[model samples]
Target: MFTTGYAANSATLQILMQKEDIAILDMGVHASVHEGCAFTNKKTFPHNNLEALEHILKMSESMYRTKLVIIDGVYSQEGDTSRAKEIYDLVKKYNAYLMIDDAHGVGVLGKTGRGALEDDGLLDKVDFITGTSSKTFGNLGGYVIANKKIASFLKFQSRQHIFSVTAPPSSAGIVKAIDLVDEEPIWKDKLWENINYLKTGLNDLGLDTGITCSAIIPVKIGDQNKMWDIGRILIENGVYTNPIMYPAVARKDARIRMTVTARHEKEHLDKTLNVFDDINKKNAYCEKNNNNYA
Candidate 1:
């Protein structure tokens, strides 16, 4: 069993002794999995480094028979994706299993929006997949899809699944949304169009959106108060966005994160661009003039 959360990692570590453990391929900018079941038993590697992954797999073959590799499909911070196909090939070569936490990829990536594994041609090769419903699925709760054995194990042993209440009534409505994502091509298309448009716009405005290949745009502001001010200005101009400061982001690289959805049209994008332009220009002038407003 593998989990993307710290709790799951901890539980897995406890279940499998550290001495029996193998390596863990963790992203450099990924959320903390510091205190997990595999915390001490882990072999940490660079983010998206398939070469390093292969080396670790080769070294451990004599020591262990079952190898597990964990990664996220779409990273929450940078919004980029894992090289699932490359990793999947490694797993196949070594007779290992691969699990992906596709929290941000469903309905926002892939030809049919199945996620990075599908995008990278490794869907069938992956051993298991976990995705959250709160993001593009536009609902609550999370899901796990796997073979009968893993599914049965998780159903009975995953503490989160066993201890948590079942999916709510509204979750039934979400199946319709998922169906629409499958039946309607326009939603994903519009979502990508908006993503590219905003990404281009942010870059044109001299804002740095770190490695974002998806709809989640993090506009680096470099200061907490300034990031908050940027968010306030966007709101004042009728363009709502979030200010992500320290703890979530690096203290020196605070940002106003914006998500462009299928719901946003050209008018919305144009207005958002205008407001950003105004704020940046005003802020630059204030800094130059030593104005208190800056």
Candidate 2:
């Protein structure tokens, strides 16, 4: 295991894919994936654009010694899942490998929360699967699932893994958390209930929530300045949320990113929705063309 999820991805890719190999990625993958490909030839397709992905795969088919297509099981920003089945099929057709980073999907997707691969019935078929303990397990390590031979190679050859400190005592907590997810399915159910409720409420209020199918919801605010003002207003009113701006998203695509958890009660969500409603009504910030408030 690596110290951080970033290390797991970056270190592994750095070792397995070198100058001769090409790393084809979906644009929405985590920053870690991009950093991992620093030494490798890399190309990126627009997020979820199958046609673009196929074009790249087809073009690079005979050129690269190894081609790896990487995508996120659930995109962190847009909160949508990967088109895993279709992508996997295309990867096979091109004779390339597929890797999925399911950090945000693991404990929140599939029939038993085994993650996006399980949801798509490709759990045992994907070439590689990487995930973190920090998100759903509430711990602090990252792991990669691969064939026995590949797993052994990574454990020894990856520089970061070779020299990194052993996982802390809290590693046990991660195991327990995984068990809890299986033992108590009710939490997943509650999480979905909260997700649907909050998403519907925001949509009804004419807020742009983007195309989110996961707990990570983005309330889209086109203007960066207005987004900052709205973020401040929400915080001052006791509703904390992430104010995402350029670099995280495009300059004009600033948004407030919110994560819905099962622990949150209806009262908490209602309070949040009420605060957003009040802010929009007072400032008219939710309106598409209204930019009067300063």
Candidate 3:
């Protein structure tokens, strides 16, 4: 395991640099992945565009020592899952490896929180799977899973693993979380219920919740300044959430990212929805007022 999920992502690219000359990435991968790829020759494909991936794979097949394709199991902003099985098949056909960074998906996907790899039935096939303890384990660290030789190789050769401060509490916490996940399945059920309730509430008000299939829902707001203004309103009303804007999203696709968890109650969701609905109306009225003044 690495110190942080970011370290895990960056270290994966570093390890690939050992033999892999080129990496193909999904455009919307976490910024840490982009930063990790700083020294590698890389190409980016449009989000989930297999055709674009194929083009790069065909070009790199004869040129690179190792060609690796990387993607997020779940996009942190929009929450859509990757077509992992398709990508796995496509990369295999090109004699390349696929690395899935499932930092957001681990402990949040699958019937048993096996993450997107399990959901896609690719736990054994995919060359590498990386994830974090922060989100689901509620701890601070990251891990990489692969064959014995690769895992051993990274354990010895990985720079991030070498220099980071060691952890005992954090490691214990993650282990405990794993045990809980195995024993208590009810958390997942309640989590999905909260997700659907909140999503329905947002939909009923006509807010543009982007293509989220997981709990990381985003209420799309195109204007960044206006999105910040609404964010302030939510804060005043006691709903804390992230404002997703460029370069996290397209300039025109700024949004308020909302995450639902088993720890949240219906009362908490109703409070959030009430504030959102109130602020939405206020914003609309102010817009009409400004137009009248014009």
TM-score of each: 0.83, 0.96, 0.94
Error of 1 at 133 (Å): 0.9
Compared with the true structure, what per-residue lDDT tens digits does model 1 show for residues 1-294? 222243343443343334565646555423434444343456666879988888887888878645677788887767778877777877788877777777778888888988777767777767767666667867676666678875676567656556656666878767888898889979999898988898888677766788888888887767688777778888988998888876776688777788888989988998998888888777652474343222
lDDT for 171 in candidate 1 is 80
Which candidate should be chosen as best, given lDDT against the real structure?
A: 2
Please count the clashing residue pairs in each candidate, in the order shown.
4, 0, 0
Model 1: ten consecutive residues of lowest lDDT = 1-10
Candidate 2 residue lDDT tens string, 1-294: 788889999988998999889999999999999999999999999999999999999999899999999999999999999999999999999999999999999989999989888867999999999999988887899989999999999998998987869898869898899998999999999999999999999887778898999899999887899889989988998899999988989888889999998898999899999988888788766355442222
On lDDT, who's better, 1 or 3?
3
lDDT of 3 at 99: 91
The predicted structure with the larger TM-score, 1 or 2, is 2
Rank order (by TM-score, best first) = 2, 3, 1
How well does candidate 3 score on lDDT at residue 68?
Answer: 85
Clashing pairs in 1: 9-37, 10-36, 10-37, 13-37
Candidate 1 colliding pairs, count: 4
Which candidate gets the maximum TM-score versus the true structure? 2
lDDT of 3 at 140: 89
